[model samples]
Target chain A: MKSVEPIFNDGFAGQPPAKRALGYIEDQKKNGKHVVGIYCGYAPVELMIALDLTPAVLCAFSNATIETAEATLPANLCPLIKSSYGFIEKDACPFYWAAEAVIAETTCDGKKKMFELIASRKPLHVMDLPQLCDEPEALDNWTTMIKKLKGFLEKTFEVQADDEAIEQAIRENNQKNRLVMEMLDHSALENPVLGWAEMLDIVFYATPGRGKLINDTLEKGVKVLQARVQNGYVHGRKGAPRILITGCPTAGDAAKVFKIIEEAGGVIVALDSCTGMKPFSEMIAENTGDPLRAIAQRYLKIPCACMTPNTRRLFELDRMIAKYRPDAVIDIVLQACHGYHVESFKVGKHIGERHHLPFLKIVTDYSPGDIGQLTTRIEGLIESIER
Target chain B: MSRSAGIDIGSRTIKLIVIDNGEVVVRKKRPSTYNPMGLCDYLLEGVSYDTIVATGYGRHLFKNYRKGEVITELKAFAVGAAHIAPSCGTVLDIGGQDTKAITIDPKGGVERFEMNDKCAAGTGRFLEIMAAALGFRYEEFAQEARLASRAEPINNMCTVFAESEVISLVTQGVPRSEIALGIHKSIVSRAINILKRVSTGRTLMFAGGVALNSCVAGLLREELGVEVIIPDDPQLVGALGCALHGQRS
Candidate 1:
């Protein structure tokens, strides 16, 4: 199949970040620098950078490694968790393989247990995440957790995360985040200027904190999209139902859902999942003096389904809807991801009652068994959305 | 005079319903082929319908096959159930390969629907597998369920796991009729689980080929404790709805 280029923007205009990050990590490994594998959203990348350790989010969303993970893990666990462990078990993910140690947050119960299995093979740091982010005690708990992370790095890796370096790290992260936001903001348009799958490709494949190259790629993408808008290029279908997709992160080549939606004549305008807009959704307080508190505050605003009293996530959804003007919402809950599955009911109520958007809850697994059924449902949903 | 056709290309059978001048003129059923497009082509070979709407598993495989578009089985079933039983607020459709529990709005729209497509546990395929395991055809399996004095409790919902349980039962000298009843009971139990996702309704309509099995449809009544309505030619409900939709569109 011939690959289609993005109509509005060219993301990762040079090499894709996933390939680039892997290559960079390999180069860093040769230079005797420790590569720290960051698993969850709560894992502190800035802190690792401050401690002179190259931090990279673990690469595990591969189809080949799932059977390897399933052999050791339970059959009914979330695909994401299985993919993570599977990537490690089969030595498939070079990012995790190159890591001297891994820092996994207790985001959900499944991942918490999966981390225990991971600890058996690799040096692992457990970051106990607080569910309620707005509560004063929760903030303090998160702040204290960040401090412990710093201390752990200092003790385990024998590196100093000095105040000056920490502030500089925060500056670097916030800068990259700003560029990513600009790239995301360009998604708000009357006509979708990019393919739904291509947009997800740019968002997900752009490695976490790959610095200059990835940042530059997103910058060029934003500029290219701006130019397209200026040139009066209406790239999307004229009256297609603009959709906002939320719920569990769609990892790796598990993009059949997006493809089905697009094929059904719904143009996905914004994605609110982990791999989409949320990772760079909130901006860190750059000049808070204490970079730890700033990083803690930013991570607290992530709006993950794992968060208890996830009203903030609903609020974020409302904000995205208002900004993007989506005609409908498609909430995807992966099978066996209990947290997202339970949260989908609340999301449905919110979308229907408050937002008044046509809601489609797709409870699916990564398996190919349900693709036809899903396509049928999505086609029906698109018809409903169009109506 | 305008005529419309609805073809439901299900996993097991293809049901074609034709409505001419707002009256049901013809209805046909044939085994679905490996080539669904060819099956649709063969079914409508000499037929003339102004509008055509397809539904079910191979519905998408009908793109460009006809003038009118294809609708999902859920939407078609909702329209069909509402048409058959005007007071049908809920629909429980168990097909050959998939099962769905749908709640219908007063305006003949689907309010909410849940499907069990990931696994074949609660589907007609489950019954077929169990019957084959008991060395009986699907018809004999239905007969076995009817003759059984009581259903033996079968808890396993997984098709692979449940087949083993059935094998173990046969080896342990449990009666085949009881085992068949137990398998039917398991499907009802799974259907109930999907139905519970949508709010319970006062009037429930049971459709799809499995609705032909009186033993299983009877269980839905005892379990739901509601007015259960099973229309004649239960499997044509989806195709009827699609034809109705085709006519309107």
Candidate 2:
């Protein structure tokens, strides 16, 4: 395995995650090495990495291409699905074309059906995700899926992935998760020690489960944050209402909501989205003999909105609320994201009634037209929470 | 008398309210032009107050112009509407740029809120733009809406396209009043669709510049199936809420 390359801004500060991730994938493509794109958290990314393929989480959530995607995709589908397919259909995502194969999961009904469309055009693989992860039968089902995925990768690429490689990958992945967790911990400070965007950029951009170099950069940032917090310093507009964001996976440029929240006089202290803090919440058992089951275990345990009987998310929310002590909980779902949107009602009812914390639910899409409206609503939420 | 003031610099209008000794002593409104900072400075040229707050789309822009909390239009509406109606459980504020429906707690805090900024339809500016395109003054168009024999169905939800549809109807020699009524119904449908996204409480209070338009207000009340209260000056609700927040501070 080659040493992971350092992403030092690619010669410019904040040169977007897609450019960096896609650039790396493009480089891998040039070298004739395989690249794989994984959608949804249920896809076994570590297994792909173990197979000597560069895994890029496919998320090009720019609002620019939604119009083209809207032609075929349902208008009511979430922006994440529409924009992702739009990236491919519009020839906007360089990484999507660069990848040798794409992986999709039945995390939701939208992505499940959407994959049937994407599969006809690109090299596609589908993983049937079990709705209930905690049940033993579901774990068995996930284990079978992971074993099938390992076989699929081996046959598709005509490459061998021994247990040793996956074990090593598991250790590497666990270390990366630990590093990411340490970085997110800074949000727990009485006053957060880093900027909301600064933390979010790291969480949003870093290649999940394999960003060794990004982890190194984040480790340095965490050290700086610790020293800053020790000195009684935090980031964002001071005295803004502290907020916790928990809902749909806010990935890529879909992070516009967090920016709007900050602009509306709210400081995001913690993010509970799949792309934000969920990946790091649990780690794989490094010493497991069957690394596929270990990977499945860790991946299945993720409290994604797709999971049925998703009580683990509530427990996780309780932990986050106790740690972050946010003044209000902002639940943002991409328009038509039923999993998060439905869970938001349960979460909202729970937190608002049980915790007596203010809960603001925001439903939006990747349209620039909604910016003013979102600002108005979120600004009002901040004010109400403050009072 | 200790006084607090609120300036709501909206996309189309600027509203200011002065609260003295816990009473709304003065209220004012001015068109929001390109130079809102200039317009705001002009509005406060001779005004005197101890503390002041600002709320609206341009709230942050006024933060440096004056030292005050940049309250959101949602909370401002919650405060202002509740102060007027007291029992206002929900607020539907249709402004020039945005339309919002917010549910407020008994303590005068916004509980849950929803907004429609994606389209100009269902807002005051929607009516204003459609009125101008039809070559009638806003007051004339609004007045015509009241005399509609029956609201003709205006199906286009997009404001720009709806205007074209209205123009098409005019070419067919359709009465301006019927088209105007149809246009008003489209916005009402838009508002009801947006309000359905969040909790629409029993006590609905209307604010923002559009609240002055009896056509939209009366129709909205009928559509929502509630007695919608309109404060003395609907546009100044945000400023009043700002002043109300100022008193608390």
Best by TM-score: 1
Candidate 2 lDDT over A16-65, as tens digits, reads: 54555566566666867788888876777778878878777775577887
lDDT string, candidate 1, A1-387, tens digits: 123335223333343336655766777778788888887777777888788788777745556667888898998888878877887887778888788788888888988888887787777888889987788888788889989888877887888977789888777777777776676766687865665555555655454445565567667767777776776665456778888999988755466888788777788888897778888777778767888888888898898988888899899998999999998898888778888899998999999899887788888766777888788678767765543
Q: Per-residue lDDT of B1-249 in model 1, one digit per residue for the tens?
A: 679899999998999999998899989888777888787888888888888888988776675655567888988998888877888899888998888888887756877677775667778878878889999977878887889999888889888899999999999999999999998988888888888877665589999989998889988889889988999999999999999988777
Provide per-model DockQ scores. 0.42, 0.48
Chain B: TM-scores of all predictions: 0.96, 0.96
Best by DockQ: 2
What are the per-model numbers of colliding residue pairs?
0, 0
Model 2, global lDDT: 0.79
